[model samples]
Target: MTTPTLGEFGRIARFFKPLAAGFPGARGLRDDAAVFGVPDGRELVVTTDAMVAGVHFFPDDAPADIAAKLMRSNLSDLAAMGAEPLAYTLVTALPRGLDESWLEGFAAGLGEEQRQFGIALAGGDSVSTSGPITLSVTAFGLVPTGRALPRWGGQPGDRVFVTGSIGDAALGLEVAYGRLDIPAQDTRAHLLRRMRRPDPRMGVGPRLIGLASGAMDVSDGLVADLGHLCEESGCAALLHADAVPLSEAARGAIDGDPVRLALAITGGDDYELLFTAPPSASDALATLAADCGVAITEIGELRPGTPGEVVVLDGAGAPLALVRRGWDHF
Candidate 1:
């Protein structure tokens, strides 16, 4: 069966224009570029994330899930910086012979998430490509001046914490690739959902403005990303694997498999926030987590050691050697 595709102008007029309808600065997406005003006493926070088919996601993945994942990935960065989402510009390099229905589904997904996150589609460009379906989203957000969280600033003795459970996305990728075995249908669904539609920790980020010392979303494996934070702060980290929170499904999959346990720690795509704060903020963090209805776990602490070093230990306190740190795109 032949697929229906739209011309560049036709696609913009039919699909993209409606997304910009109510945003005045977007100029209805008719102009070549968008214009907007920054709020008083607030700083604009900008972030960009791109996902390529067959690299970040499977080519045969659902178009809606792909769109949602792309948006959340960009939003997670803003969340790490303690910002509230405002708008985004999208750019897509679509493959030839793509179905028009795919565009509809993708736009629908984007619209739904935009409404949920209180953001709008400002403007963007779409072009055809012979390669995979690649998507890049440049998201805009706002934070108070001089208050945005940095990747550094954590001191020795600060508590290292993470929001939500880890390893689900990595396991979800395993489930999607048919590399892992799961007999329960519900468990499979949970893992797949975590992979396709990760929550961006939007609510928790705003509340962390005066609390967290340093923060970054866990995109690369937890260990690798935390190592980045450590390097930026000129310190080291001691991560307790036993203290790393995991979804019930993740625990079930690992059971007693040492390899799966390692993957859970090092595998990436867990969009949860990895942050550090002083012990004085523990109660406040707990209160914030409760208010936001997100789980918060103290996995370890930043310490004085070789900068950029991340040491992971087992329950018995023995150092565990990790073969791979996390996902790296060359």
Candidate 2:
């Protein structure tokens, strides 16, 4: 016998409404739109990111992880703007025959992140789709007036910094694809986690207000994203290959293989923040990293030259040729 299906309203009332609990602005997901007053002395920052099954994530991946990734991806944008997350709206398009259990897990994931990041689900829409699962999150954050980091403020001689080690997510995708043979289980597990879960540098971004001249999250590969910053700021960049921080797991994967190193450089999906600051603020940034309990590394510098030019130099001062910069939507 065919089973009954949970319609849109029923699904929202059963799974999503609880996720919006305690947020008066959400109006229990009953209102047409959420309403909230911005706190005094702060401005709102909004960003949206979308994830699709088989493109952004594996089709069989955990519902919760997929939900978390979508939320974190949007949150990373807010972090790049030096804002703290306040609230978010989620919209999900589910494939035909989607199980109620899947919705439960997805909502649970959103609920968990809401509590962890001190945000709430204001409202959202859920609909069934004939194609793959698609989820979008529009996150809201707040920053002090005129303190949000500017994407176009990077200047020549500004030191480039990145939060946490790089390239783990790229290698993590390799692990997910079963292409890499990592003998160490710990290393494999680490890479897998990096691919499945991304950490948005929310704590560090706030401390960078008025300190960083420019900032953005590294959604694309490092080289490609930095090139974007340069193009926007009308500057070039000279990146030291040796200084690009790598996790122990990534190092192991790249050991003795220069191609693997190149993958680390060009492979995308890292949600870490990439920001430019003056030399004088280096010490302050260091302190901020310490306080945030996340590693910050100096990888390159902006230079006065052709816009969109990104040069990667080896430790011996020789330029390294890269075939691809990072993931491109086109």
Reference-based TM-score of each model: 0.98, 0.97
* Model 2 Cα lDDT, one tens digit per residue, 1-330: 223667888888988888888688999999899999988899999999998898999989998898888888889899999999988898899876887788788889888888888889899888888999999999999999888998779999999999998899999998888898888999998988887878999899888887889999998899999999899999999999999999999998898576898889888878999999989998898888889899999999999999989999998999999999989943
Clashing pairs in 1: none
Instruction: Tell me the spans in candidate 1 whose CA falls farther than 4 Å from its real position.
Output: none
Mark the regions of model 2 whose C-alpha exceeds 4 Å error after superposition.
1-3
Q: For residues 1-330, what per-residue lDDT tens digits would candidate 1 score against the true structure? A: 446666899899888888877678899987889999998999999999999999888888888899899999999999999999999999999987888888889998888888888888899999989999999999999999999999898999999999999999999989988999899999999999999999899999988888999999999999999999999999999999999999999999989576898999899999999999999999999899899999999999999999889999999999989998888853
Worst 10 residues of 2 by lDDT: 1-10
How many clashes would you count in candidate 2? 0
> All candidates' lDDT scores?
0.92, 0.89
